[model samples]
Target: MGYAGRHVAALLQSLGVACSGTVRNVAVAPEVIRDAEAVLCTVPPDEDGDPVLRLLMKQLRDSASLRWVGYLSSTAVYADREGGWVDEQSDADAVDETARRRLLAERQWRALARDKGIASSVFRLPGLYGRGRNALVQLAEGRARHVVKPGLVFNRLHVEDLATAVVAAMRRAEPEALYLPCDDEAAAPQAVLAYAAALGGFEMPPAVAWDDPSLSPALRRFYAGCKRIDSRGTREALQWAPRFATYREGLQDAFRG
Candidate 1:
């Protein structure tokens, strides 16, 4: 998400629009965001990988002077329906502890905009895939494992699309808007990995099930997640199209070099 923000921020700036990026829990260098107009925040691993939104609302409310505040949120805030599809209108269950914590933060930010009159918006993004972060690259290089879990699927968006949606949110400058951002396809873990390897012009590597007891708990939890989400709203509202609409498309570019 951080990398995606840089791409979008630079794009917006190149178009003659000044942009500001806020960093949470760190000393932001003045030069990183000296020229500013709108503020886009993609702060995380939220103070231990999930900071409550109240802290940010207080911090943001304390500082003002921007046309809009764009919050880069995650679709993990949605409930785990075990492969069932979820949309922006769906109720978020925040199944695991981390997601539950993220949900609380989202509620706080939404309230800050609605009741307190802060010009804010929420962008719930699906699983992100992009340059240097491609799962196949990670798996092939031994940084990540590709394990399939029953009843777990993932929706993905190329970072370019995520960045575009964020820019669209900022462009509209809506006082309090919520949008679900995702790509055109939802795929299983093995499917995503195989596609990446295919793009690399290599045969798909074999992998064990996530249920294999040899796996670590953290990896197991990550493999257990079902990243199903809908993004009709982004296309309708932003009038934006992704240059890399699918992970396959983006993965090809990542390995092309």
Candidate 2:
């Protein structure tokens, strides 16, 4: 299982709900799909398209007990809003190859559910961090960086909040539903790193320019995006709210842990 899938599965198991999942590069047992009441696909698409659907579409279609399907997608599906707000109804204008692939995978999953008369929900996730996977860990490992870019902001969600929203969505099982699970605040990357440093009593790392030559291509692409994800509709529909409503609370929790 990947990061989000593992947390979701753990949450389900803790609630005494039976769950099964496939690990990356591992062959999945047919019964994993055949006997489930619900299925959540967290796999990302490759150049060839959705690997899960390629291998398991037949099993998913044939499953007698499956009633609901969920797909984890990226907020990158929405075009960069130039620091404006984007909601669930925002048009998907995927600008990058990775995001385009994700959008395609979302369509494939929704089509499958529609064909089978099963409810399907898609969660559009922003940057995710929690516990061991947070800025504190980065600071401790000496890999933390403070990237300075004025008017640039990014949305994030704590993994625990993600798990909670996913369970809530499963309970609702709304047909063709879409969700944006994000914290209340859209913050600058450097601000988050600075806050983490203060929380963990570590010295703040030197700020790097957004155009720093040392930044990886992927990191540069991340900085190119500027949007505030609006999750009000998701909250109203799911009756859910993030426990860590801002990066401050999320980093605080990670610091304490």
Candidate 3:
């Protein structure tokens, strides 16, 4: 959560928004957000379930002042489209364990809002990348890998664009809405890395087979899926588009930073 929350908090604070506090611990959410009118939950679900809903369901349901509730979810919840496009109305047949759990958590939040009449918005985010977490940083630290896999494509969102989308959602206070926020372009990891290398003036990292035994389990899982995600529905609904429309622009921004 620290990855996106800290950047988002900074952005919100700069916009003159009155943010009470960033809730680092779910157990203390009730106290931290006692008087908040709008709340954004970026907490990830564990094996048990969504920690925030599990811990602060009563407090959230009881808060009369709470108007807008936003839950940050992932695009992994959608089924693999084999490099095809998927949108908000697409089939959400989550195959992996993590995606399955996230789907359950999303349902829980939507149901909670319905039962309590709270304006709930779920933003299904794609792979996130920004200043300190982009290909530039990865290549600078010599940790960038070019995983060679045919027909593999991924959609990514710059953290700043995500921040913008979330703030727009807050302004509209859309009730019981689902959105998928991603950049305009979806490409392979190698293509992104090559672009980053050109900007950083370094040779691209050596290619690694997608099935290399040295790859971590998490990376293996990431490589297992190939899909192109589209957020046109979200853009139309929120009247917002990604500032960095593709990895090329996003990586350039990070490199400039």
Candidate 4:
């Protein structure tokens, strides 16, 4: 949702369209924003259905003149594959707390949009990195570990790429469509950490087995599964491509800063 708002807001402002955003605290103020030419919802769904979603839907439905509703979701909602690949067409088999919660949230928002009669699309994003957000800095600071979770690989994207995807979707958002936003490469966690370590002029972090008792059971389970997402829908539909294709290039860019 943050990705949607930060970019879409600028996009709106660039076009001279009056815009207003809502959070859990400010959703009730839609009346103040009712005059907005477009309403791009960046609100995320809770583990349960978002209460504000119903309210937002009601407002969007009741508003006399409103256009555009976008829902932000996670690619983590995709089923864990134990190192298999998934696409927008794949089923969701959430394997951990975060993924399970996100899957539930995606379902709730889709249901709300259907019942409320709103034009909405969901963007499923991969691991996000940009600016100061890349893992290189963390690994450089000795906070990141290249865990040898060999079976798992994940697609990643820069925030700028994610931003452009949202803009592209808005340029052609339909009533109900699911979009997967990702870049070309999928790397194991250890691989990304190793790259980050190299950027910091250090050796890779020690390998830690998932069953190591030193690691919390919950965290171990979180790291137990791997996911590789397909981004063909995003590439074909949006006619988009990523600037940072791999961690090595991306980290070098990050390090240069």
Which number leads on lDDT?
Answer: 2
Model 3 lDDT, residue 174, Cα: 73
Candidate 2 backbone collisions, by pair:
none
Lowest summed lDDT across 10 adjacent residues in model 2 is found at 22-31
Task: For model 2, state the Cα shift of residue 150 in Å.
Answer: 0.8
Clashing pairs in 1: 45-49, 46-51, 53-105, 79-93
Q: lDDT of each model, Cα atoms only?
A: 0.68, 0.89, 0.84, 0.69
Stretches of model 1 off by over 4 angstroms after superposition: 20-36, 45-59, 62-64, 201-205
Query: Where does candidate 3 have its weakest 10-residue lDDT segment?
Result: 20-29
lDDT for model 4 comes to 0.69
**Candidate 4 structure quality by residue, lDDT tens digits, 1-257:** 26547666666567765655555456356775566434555565555655455565566566656455566777766666877788878877677566766666666666655665755667887767866777777766777655566567778887767767777777775667788877778888788777777667777767887678888877676676678878887688878887777766777887888
Task: Rank the candidate models, highest lDDT first.
Answer: 2, 3, 4, 1
Where does candidate 2 stray beyond 4 Å?
none
Tens-digit lDDT string for candidate 1 (62-178)? 444535666677787766667777876788777777676566666666665666465677888776778778876786686656687766777788877777787777777777788
* TM-score of every candidate: 0.83, 0.96, 0.94, 0.83
lDDT of 2 by residue, 120-185 (tens): 999999999998899999999999988888899989999999999999999999999999999999
Query: Model 3 scores what on Cα lDDT?
Result: 0.84
RMSD of each: 3.3, 1.2, 1.5, 2.9
Using lDDT as the measure, name the better of candidate 2 and candidate 4: 2
